[model samples]
Target: MPIIGMCIDLVAPSLPAIGQSFSVAASVAKSVISLYLLGFAFGNFLSGFLIDSYGRQKIIRLSLLGFIVASLMPIYLHSITWLLFARILQGLTIGAVSVTLRSICADVLPPERLTKLGPWFGTMWGIGPVIGPVIGGYLQVYFGWQAGFYFFAIITLIAFIVVFIVVPETHFNRHPLRIVSIKNNITEILKNHVFIGITALMGLSYALMILFNVSGPFLIQTTLHYSPIFFGHIALYLGVVFVLATFLGRYLLKAHTVEKIWLIAINVSLLVGIIAVIVSYFFKDSVILTTLITALMFISCGVVFPISLGKGLSLFRHIAGTATAVMYLVNISISSIVAYFAGFVDMTSLVPLAWMYLFLVFVIAILYWTVLRKS
Candidate 1:
């Protein structure tokens, strides 16, 4: 999850240089990031199914190869379209890696362990976006954008090797693979609500950050007139907030239910909306204050993701792959589209982000209170 999130950051710092290299506008060059995410959404669903039918080990090994290969594309090619293609490919691989890993975590650990794992999991994935621009900035300034891709590819290669040697198929099926059986099982997996809700919530939780991906750089660099490095630091702070909040949630779980964690996180969403209004209008667009508030919004992500993910996957042990697919499909699909178009929304004022935040918060809140709480 962390690796997937961080992958795009490798390209962020290089956006300007990449734009110049491709002779495109900064906005146009952003397609590298946008298309990658779209590819990510596309792959999330595919991998969910693949994990179930093919077995995690095979999917894991193959996806890692894809990730490493895609990460290396920029090392040889200078064309913007090719770079975009690499990103798309990497996105698909990342989606598979993320969904599989989360499914593995769900299988291997109990709720206590899940809570313990939450901060670490959130921290790893959160580090991607936060750290990407930071590294990309320095590399773009010192070495070059190409260097970032090279390094990223190399690191993921190591990760792939480690997983290949150490990871095994957690899903112990007595039977061998068969085409008719695979389709029938997948049909059954898609029918479960627990998996559906978990995945839906996954997308919702992630949407907060994805919107940040689309608007964050522009908001900090263009609207607020801060440097990319400054924005990167802000990203770091938000990542830190998420990390710490996840830790806090880990402790909370010792005494509370997953539902309780969701409730608190939902409350945080409301606070973020309220803060967005104040930051947008009152502060007159101060980056420091805005960043701080945004981090709080992101903190809610820590709470819901780890808890809901664990709870949702627990009920679908019989069909882990199909359950996971549902989770990623809903989560990635909704967030990517939302984040992509959200770019067009006016973030010059916090009003747009504020309204969207409030709308989502209330929607989830009402759903939980009237529907889920009863369940």
Candidate 2:
């Protein structure tokens, strides 16, 4: 999971250098990130049925092999187009790894155990984003942009070896490998209002995270005129907020219902968005204030995601792979769309980010209060 998280954001600090190397603008370079997410969404959509048909171990090994090959493309080929292809492949493998892992957890653990352990999953996941850019920054300074991909290939190779040695096949219940069967399974899960609501909330929560991931580099580096190292440090700090919040949530889950924790997170996020709007408009690009407020939002998101994900998967333990895939498909897809449109927003001002945050929070409220509550 930490490797998956690392793969996703490791290139953030290198976007500008990549653009200069390719003789393109930052906007075009950003596509490398977005295209990877697009592939991840597709992979998540398809991996559900495939993992259920085949086995987790087989698919994961093959995906990691594919990921390694793809990671080597741009480093050797030296083309932005090739880099985009590599990112897509990375996303595909990441989706397979993430969905399969989640399903395995659901397969091995009961609902109560799953709930207790979810935050630990989230905390480890949070650690990757915390250190990825910092690592990427030093790599970029020492070796170059291609070095990041080299790191990915090597680390993923080790992961492949580790999985081959230690991980066992966890899928006990298998569905038919028919297209009709897969479609019907997916349709049945979607029809559950509780599943839909929680998944939607989960996706939107992740979109908030992606929004920051995509925009943060440009905002901190270009608009705010900060050094890449400084931006990396800021990212590390904000990422720590998320890790700590997940730990706090681990304690909260002992006594509180998941919904209660989720609602509290929502309220805190709402307050942060409101404060961000006021500060971004009046103070107008106060770096310290904006960064800290956005960190608070990430903290809220850190709490919401694990709880929502754990509960949603618990709702469909029989089809854990499909359910988990659908959940991530929604998350990566929405996050990609939100990140793409965010390019049009003025990075000089925090208003756009603040507005986006508030809008997502509003949707989360409706999903919870109107849909999940009744269901």
Best of the candidates, lDDT: 2
Off by over 4 Å in 1: 16-27, 106-120, 174-183
Local distance difference test, each candidate: 0.71, 0.81
**Candidate 1's TM-score:** 0.88
RMSD (Å) per prediction: 2.8, 1.5
lDDT of 1 by residue, 1-375 (tens): 557767766666565567677797656666676777778876766886677656678888888889888888877876877888998898888888887887677667775565456556766776676667677667776787788888778888888889988998885552245667667766676676555666667677777766666666766776777666676667777767777777776778788888877877887687778767766777756776667666776777777776676666666666666666666666777776776667556567556666677666676677677656766
lDDT of 1: 0.71
Q: Which residue pairs collide in model 1, if any?
A: 2-124, 2-125, 6-128, 199-327, 203-331
Quickly count the clashes in candidate 1: 5
TM-scores, each model vs. reference? 0.88, 0.96
State the lDDT of candidate 2 residue by residue for 69-181, as single tens digits: 98899988988888888888889878888888887788899987876777878888888889987888777778888888999899889999999999999886788799798
Clashes of each: 5, 0
